[model samples]
Target: MTPIIVFSVITGYFGLLMLISYLTSRKSDNDTFFTGNRKSPWYLVAYGMVGASLSGVTFISVPGEVANTGWTYLQFVLGNIVGYVIIAFVLIPLFYKLNLISIYEYLKDRFGLKSYRTGASFFLISQTIGASFRLFLAAIVLQIAFFDSFGIPFWVTVLVTISLIWLYTFRGGIKTIVWTDTIQTTFLLLAVTISIIVILSQLNLSFDDAIKLVTTSPKSKLFEWDWLSDRNFFKTFTAGIFITIAMNGLDQNVMQKNLTCKNVKDAQKNILWFSITFLISTLLFLILGVLLYQYALANNIPIPERTDDLYPLLALNYFGLLVGIVFLLGIIAAAFSSADSALTALTTSFCIDILNIRKTKTVQKKTRLYVHIGFTMLMFLVIIVFNSFNDASVVSAVFKVAGFTYGPILGLYSFGLITRKKVKDKLVPLICIIAPILSIILNYNSEKWFNGFKFGFEILIVNAILTMLGLWLITIKPKTSLN
Candidate 1:
């Protein structure tokens, strides 16, 4: 597709989202922005979570890695199913029971003021980086496909991308995102389904032939039993369980939408259905990955050095004009669905956790507006910084950071939920900070120190354990009774 056509496609898509924003935000209030007035339909939230969860990182990175990693990510997805079940049954009920706007409020109730702040602070730091990573992929795509033609610097593209999200989300917040994300999810699914069909038609391969090839190819290997390898099934599976719990269950962004459902039953229904779809959609991405590698080999196309670029390069340059336009829309949808919510979630957290705005209810609407704009700007800066230094696959980078950022969170929740013991609330901030730093040191030296025991997705598990151990140490002892 020509740059003009690509730009037009994006413009029309944004216009559609803006229209949805206008409709959704018509009677917006703090309740609408933070919790969607607790009236969102379970089904819409279910479908929309898929797009927000996958985002551009998964859209680009999953299929790209298929050539090398095969279907092993399915191990993580399987683990995620288990994780989602835990969230649906355990975490969802707790959030609804408390009627929480920010999930972090539970920490305050269970522990003390310090622990509450610690959980909210970790969420803020981790989510900012995670959201930035997701947005960076879309920015890269736009720069390559359209902006370069106009001699536009990458920063301008980043600004425009972040600003559009701010423009729509500042008013309605999660209320707008719930509707916008459903629309984004529809386009995302359409784009993937169309891209798969186009590739099959181009290769003249029947469904049976495609399946047969994927099953037989070494590139489609799904199991890694090498205990020393980073992609071992056990590590990936366990890590998948904890990562989901930490990133979605413990983190604000993912849980924010679920808390918007009318009640616990409705929210549980949303999560349960979303997990099944999340697994199937990811499976489709893997199938596409195998097809991408096979197609490249057959046509004598040189694979891009950074495998993350493979999907975009093939779609935009080789898949024909129609596929290019759809793929572009898919990525944009993925980007906005994720980033827009992160902005809302961040604003919600800051207003609730940091500023304690509920105490000063008079200024909430005005305060939320300023906080929303501040996060939008923060995300832009983070993306620009990432663009300068990013070298690893985005999926890998995100997971690696999650290992550090989410580790303390997973630890805090585990300690609070599993045990009825009192915590040294004042010590929690110190413990949360120390756990991640220790995790970094241990992850850095594990291979050399442990005779090639590599930490992959399991880093989150290790970090959480360390955090729990720290919490255990700081518990108060009961005095002996002399009767």
Candidate 2:
């Protein structure tokens, strides 16, 4: 496909998003922009989350991972269900009771200002890097498909894509995001389902035969009980728990949607339904990967050099132009599903938590407008910088960065909610810094030091442990006076 043509199709899709944003923004207030006025329908939020949680990173990365880990990645998603249940019933209630505008504010009330800023800062760092990496992966596919033709650099494509996202999302914020996410999620699911059907037809296998072929493939195996290794079934499962809890239960990006529901009960229902949809949707993608491998085997299609490119290559070669167009639409949908929400959430958190902007009060209208514009510009700048240095895999980079910030937040909340351990507010920053740095060191050298056993999911555990221990060292217990 021509670069201009591909660009036009992508632009058209985003234009639709822009239209939705325009209509939604007409009713948006600070509450709507930040939390959808706490009145959004649970089912729509749940449906939209499937796409937001997976994104293009999962869309491309999961199938690639399947080629290596078999179906064992599903173990993490299975673990995610346990984590999601905890968030729905346990975490959501805590936030609702606190009546928090920003979830991190609960940390401030429970702990102190230092702890609150620490949590929010960590989220800012992790979410930014993680979101950028997702965009990086999507940009790679678009570049390969179009811009690689005439010496147009990848960075140019990246900037243009970010620009389109920023333009549509600058005004409507979360109210717009909820609806946009639902639309994008629909496209993403359709893309995956259609790709499976196309690949099955190519193998001359009926749907039943195709599924049987996948089920029997080596990549289809799901369980590995080893606890000593990175992909150890138990370890990956545990990691899923921490990842879902830390990122969704605590982070602004995911919970920002949860907070939009009309009441605590509805928010809980939204989270519960989101888990089911996310789990089933990811399984479908994994099945597609297994079938893609089978189709490759049967038809003698050459697998791409990197597994991440497998879906795109197959779409381009195996399905002809029409199917390839559909695949492109899916890729765009997945990419924007997470990216747009991240941009909106980042702005929401920063404006509300850091700038003290309020949607409920109209007096500060001019200041809030500036803050929104400032955040939009900042996003454009950060994405440009992130796109320039693209050397790592999207998933690994996201987890690594997430580990740094999420661990400390996990520790902060755990300490405050589970115990009345009177933490010294002044020393909070040092503990948060030390915990993740130490965890990274352990993550890197754990294998060599521990007889080839390594920390994967256990890294979060260690990070949390280190943070807790650090807090203990810094906190001074008060003496109770006998009355």
Candidate 3:
């Protein structure tokens, strides 16, 4: 894998994405950009979402994490199935009934104007951070493989990465993403499948032998019954459910695609199918992780200090030229599938939720185009900032941040749906801010305060609970109607 070959593969891949954009964006308007004219096929949305849901973080980080955590992450994946079920039955119907362009609009109907803005603001902040961190992972890989040889700086890599996403996404928006993601998902799965085959060949293991190796390895341990450990099955499983509810059900990035379907039924079908496929995809990644570690051990290769680097290190240095190319393609596809959608969702939230762009239809198109460009720059800058300070595993870092930021959203939506009491709208923002802060304090001191209990993804559940409590304390009963 010369730098030239890596660059060429990326160039060809990006060209395909731009071609899709050109085809879908023609005669596109605000309706198409935001909702895909509400005519997207249910099955395509299901397929594309598999790519978006996995993102670059899952592509590289999840497999790498398998060495340390083993199959405990699957507990969280099972929880995701429960969460997706809730989204399909509970959240989808609400968004559909409201005919929402931005899912946050439900806050306005349920609470008030301030609560609406508060929810949208939280989403903007959460998505910006989440998307930036994801792009940062991809940019690092690109810099190592392609740009460093050319003496390009990291910031330049960040700019080019985001700029490429903006180029394909600026016009077509969700309309284009629905189709492009399907293509990206195809490549992503192919890359993973091909890599598995190549690695099995290198190790001289047949398919049955490979399965036997992964299943019988110590890394195959999936259950943890220790109540005090963060990886405990109950804790991780519960956290996965809430994480999905908050990150997917309440997230504009994920829900925007779901909302593109023709109706509630189609959207539900998409969620159900996407959930099943996503689970299968995740199982494959975990299996690949087991194989990578096994191959390294048998070859007497020292594993990298960072688990996230294992796949890249082996593929580029030892797996020969073809595996190197497959690695690059898989990562690039995963990166764009996630980043492109995040950009669109950020722009959509800003225009609809922050600036009320829908109210000013005359200039909405121009305004949206500008906002899209602006967010692209913002993400580039955020990625640079993250690069300066980030040291932890990115997969852990992303879920940690999501726990804090998405907590208020989970709390807000739960309150609106489960209760009839009216809230003090002006104070909602303060409660949202306070809940995560309290969660941080508790998480930092969990061992002392709770008899050596460690928090994992379940921290998200705590944060949401605190937010719900805050909201509850501020609630007032609805006034009785006079007869």
Which stretches of candidate 1 lie above 4 Å from their native place?
A: 479-483
Clash counts for the predictions, in order: 0, 1, 0
TM-scores, all candidates, are: 0.98, 0.95, 0.98
Model 3 is weakest, by summed lDDT over 10 consecutive residues, at: 357-366
Q: For candidate 1, what is the TM-score?
A: 0.98
Clashes of 3: 0
Rank order by TM-score, top first? 1, 3, 2
**lDDT string, candidate 3, 352-413, tens digits:** 98999877738578899999999999988889899999888899999999999999999999
Per-residue CA lDDT of candidate 2, range 35-112, in tens?
Answer: 777778989899988888989878888887787888888888888999999898888988888888789888788778
Clashes by residue pair, model 1: none
Candidate 3: how large is its RMSD? 1.2
Encode model 1's per-residue lDDT on 299-371: one tens digit a residue: 9999999999999999999999888998999999999999999999999999999999888738579988999
**Clashes by residue pair, model 2:** 30-359
lDDT of 1: 0.92
